[model samples]
Target: MTVDYSLPKPELGAPVRVSPFIRFCRWGLLFAGIAYGMKRQRTLEQRETAHRANLRAQKVIWDEEQKKIATQRTREQLLQLAKDVNVPIPADFDTQYPPA
Candidate 1:
């Protein structure tokens, strides 16, 4: 006689049974997960906001520096042009474009 070794086929219409303890904790687990997610999301949003603010402040400082540099260059160029043409520098020229 031959021995049977094949596993039985699963029934498609069988109902799944959940443990009572797990079912009792389902709502608590869902709420805890949601609470944790919200806390993490809030932390991330705060960090991103702080980073953006830092970038904005840096940009403002950078723009101000660029403007200052441009102003200085323009002043120097004007002074040089006046000297090349043998024009006397106005008394207030130094006051307006104080030495770099």
Candidate 2:
């Protein structure tokens, strides 16, 4: 017998039907996921900006402290040198000689 290729084959199972409500729910879920991802990204960027600002402030404070310490040490060294050489320390010593 010759096989006929013109007729449409019968479906093995029931045709799948997607309801309107299910389609709407799927779209809603997709939108919600996109919104949540955008919000999360913005939050992370804000946190990074705040962290950088805090680091810069800390660095400024540290630099000021270092300068103060260096100046105090220089003053102490100058006093010791003057005492060793038997020379009187000048009244405007800090202005007369700056730290190297």
The numbered model that scores best in TM-score is 1
What pairs collide in candidate 2?
none
- How many angstroms is residue 39 displaced in model 1 relative to the true structure, after the best TM-score fit? 0.4
Taking all chains together, the TM-score of candidate 2 against the true structure is: 0.47
Task: Give model 1 RMSD, 1 decimal.
Answer: 8.0
In model 2, how many backbone clashes occur? 0
Count of steric clashes across candidates, in order = 0, 0
Q: After superposition, how far is residue 21 of candidate 1 from its true place, in Å?
A: 1.8
Cα lDDT of all candidates, in order?
A: 0.93, 0.90
**Candidate 2 lDDT trough over 10 residues, lowest sum:** 91-100
Query: Model 1, residue 99: what's the lDDT?
Result: 70
lDDT of model 2 at residue 62? 97
Question: How far does residue 42 in candidate 1 sit from its true spot (Å)?
Answer: 1.2
Worst 10 residues of 1 by lDDT: 10-19
